[model samples]
Structures are given as structure tokens and as C-alpha cells.
Target: METRDFELLIGRNIIEKYRADRHRPAVFALAGLEWDLLDEVWPPTYSPGGELFAGRIPFDRMSSFLEMGCGTGIMSVLAARAGVERVLGLDINPAAVRNTELNARRHAVADRVTARESDLYSAVGPDERFDGIYWNPPFLNAPEDSVDTSIWDETMFDPEYAKLRRFLAEGRELLTPRGKAYLWFGEALGNPALVADLAEETGYDLGVLAKTEMAEIPEALADAFPADLVGGDSEDGEDAAWHLHLLELRPRQA
Candidate 1:
């Protein structure tokens, strides 16, 4: 699908809509591949804000890597281009897992990268580890409407910020000493301070790589970026939610 086909989410709210042609199939362009993903749930696109944050990090050559929460496999493809020998993209959703696999083939990196349906590190071998890792965790803090169904957050809905904290804690075991992790975070939920605390509590060194304020949303994506994703935007005569912060992470080895 064309970039114009994607929509936006604006204002500070828990959930929004992506009125794209859901039936046409979902695809994302990453590192040259426009791989088709299962859109039974919404598929993620690289927005200007997200891309800008992603562009800031100076990824270094690494022996092997892992990308948790690899939605649409966009970041994973970028890691592959950065010269990682092998990369594993892991997520909890089956649809996302399938999408990631297709995207890897689209970039002709299927052999170099793999996608797995895993709840955190459940599927990973206890002995498995990595030199470098990348993650764009679900960092939004919004109250869920009901605990009934955990809607796929590909569209950036507000849910308890549980996944990120868990990753910060458990991800340490997966890192190889001298290893580094490239983590991108959207500060819509006011998470900079919280992330810092988590980093310290988890015993990892923190580094702020890139950050930008949520200025304005495009006409199209006014409903996709989600108010909770970009600090909320109002139509007129009022201010929207304000947010900003993005960065990478390192596993402390002292």
C-alpha cells in the first residue's frame, strides 16, 4: 500500500482508528522490502516521528542481534542492513510474527533474519544470547477500556506499560557481555523518568540517542498515531497532550 494509504491518530485518547483499506492487505517498507503482513489487526507504518527517532541511532556492526516487539519487522530489517550476522525478531502476536517472516523474505534476508511468535523470551533457548538488540516496546500508559480483549496495539493504543518494564528486567539475561541494545521509545506516556528508573533498577546503563516533540499530526494520520502515542492533538482553541523522548540502552557489566 502507498504511504498515503496509511492514517494517523491524534489527541490524547486510549484508542483510535486506522481507516485504511483493511481488506487490501497490510505491508510495510523496511530496508527495501514491502512485505505483506496479516492485517486481521492493524499493521504499523513508519511515521515521520518514529522514523526520525529511528534515524538518530548510530547502529554499529555486530556479530548477532535480537529485536523484541518487532512489529512489521521494520526495525529488524534496518538492523540486518547494519551488518548484524544474524537477527531474530520476536513478538507475542501470531499475525505480527507472520508479517515479520514475510518482510524478511521481501528484503531477501530470510536466511539472515527470523521471526518467532514468543511472549518475551519464552521461545528463546535459555542458552541463546546476543551482542546487540533493538526494541520499540509498547510504552504507552493508558487505562484499558476493559480487560476483555487485549486489542492488537499495532495502531498504538494505550494499555498498561507492562511489556516494557518486563523487558527491561528480563532482557538483561539475553545480552552478551560488552553487548549493546538499541531501544527506541515514544514518550507520549511521560515515560522518560520511568524508563530511567527502570534502567537503574534493572542494572543497565542508559543512553538517550534521539528525541523529538510531538508538534503536529498530518491530515491523514490524525487518527492513527493515537493521542496516547504523540501526546494528544486537539482541533482548535485547546492544546493536546505533550510528549517527547527516545533512546538506546546498554546492559551494564560492572
Candidate 2:
């Protein structure tokens, strides 16, 4: 199927799913950290991308940790628990900010975790730096031509992949001299050209630190995703499940 057709079909599936059941509250553990997340944000149970991202964090504590698009604030709380001196969670949705704050308090990390509403790095201060930064960016490259929109859909759609590239470019600036950045990249959700261009533009070397098998895609979205890209079918049957990879990015040598 064509990319446009595929994107629209995914968009329709997202809208339909959101309208059916948007607010689902659940408790779950990720990378040994317990999370009580509202369905208003991305659910960590069905979605293991966040958990996978949490697992790749360095064992040693850092001075500061920055998390962008902190849906449900799981990573921020986990970062605080990991002994980061300070933790800042940024999200464009006010509800996400509030959710992170609540989660931080619930996890007894409120003292170190600060959640704020910001579109990527816009709200980050000029001089601020972090020893570690993380982002689980919106995956789907869906077009924004649809008339209907909702908060839940934000997790699935990226228009022209603007935010994805912007995050890579601007996020590079927020890293401390010794800081490292990580992003969750699903093979199916991203295009090679965009990824290559972003890496070149930022002058950063992207490396895979870890990977996790993603949950099964809903049957409703089957047609929207290419079977080969999502790893649903193969003669060998080894690549049956989709995988989310943790990418560690750092500046190239001079």
C-alpha cells in the first residue's frame, strides 16, 4: 500500500480506538519500577517501549536527567529512583505534565522530579544541562490532514516527522559534556531517509544499546502496517514479533 493510504488508515484506527475507551487506569511494573498510570497517557502495560527505554539507563547515578514527551512520567520517576540529582519531565500536554507530577509524588520522588508543559526544548533553560536525556517520540508518520483530533492520538502520530527531527537537533544542545541521550526507535514507525538525515544534520552517531520485543499490533491496525516492516511474517518465523530498540546517540569525533 502507498504511504499516504497507510497513514490515513492508521489515523482512522487511532481515532476510533480513542473514542471507544480513552481513560483506562492501571498499575504495572517496568524495569523494576512500579507505575500507576492513567489511560489518558500512554499505558505502559500494553506498550513496552517506555519500559524498554527504562531498562537501558546507566546503572550509575548522574547529576541530572531530562525526559522529553514523558507520557505518564514513568521514565522521570525511574530516573529519580536511579539516583539522578535532578529530574525534569517535559510534555506538550498539560495532562501529561500533571500525570508525571502525580506519579513522581506517588513514587516518593517529587523532590527531585519536576514535570513541565513544553513543546520539546522550548521550555528548557539556556544554561541547563543533564547527564542523561531520554525520549520516546511519537511513532506513526501519520499526516495531519484529518479533521478529528484528541490527546490520546498524540502518542501515535507525527506530522512530516517535524517533532522527531526537532527533538534530535535541539535535544543535542541540552546534553552535558558527559551526558548521553537515548531515543526509542521502532523499525516500522520510522523511515530510513529521515533517520539518516537527522543523524547527519546533528553530527551524532546513533548506536543501539538494547532492544525489546514489542507487544503485538492490534488486528485493526494490521492493514495500516506493512507486514514485512513490523516483522509479522517470514518463512523462517523467527521475526514474528516487532521490536523496539534503544538508540544511544553521541557526538562524532572531531
Clashes of each: 14, 0
Give lDDT for model 2: 0.74
User: On residues 1-254, what C-alpha lDDT tens digit does candidate 1 reach at each position?
Assistant: 21111211232232434443444445545334465767653455424334345556454646677887776777677667667778888877777777778777877778878889887778788788888667766554545553223434533532445666777778788878867766666554346677788888888888877666556654544555534434344568467644555566787776
Question: Which residue runs of candidate 2 sit more than 4 Å off their true CA positions?
Answer: 59-61, 147-150, 218-241
Residue 74 accuracy (lDDT) in model 2? 83
Off by over 4 Å in 1: 1-16, 19-25, 28-33, 46-59, 148-160, 218-221, 224-244
RMSD of 2: 3.4
TM-score of each: 0.75, 0.84
Q: Residue 86 CA error for candidate 1 (Å)?
A: 0.9
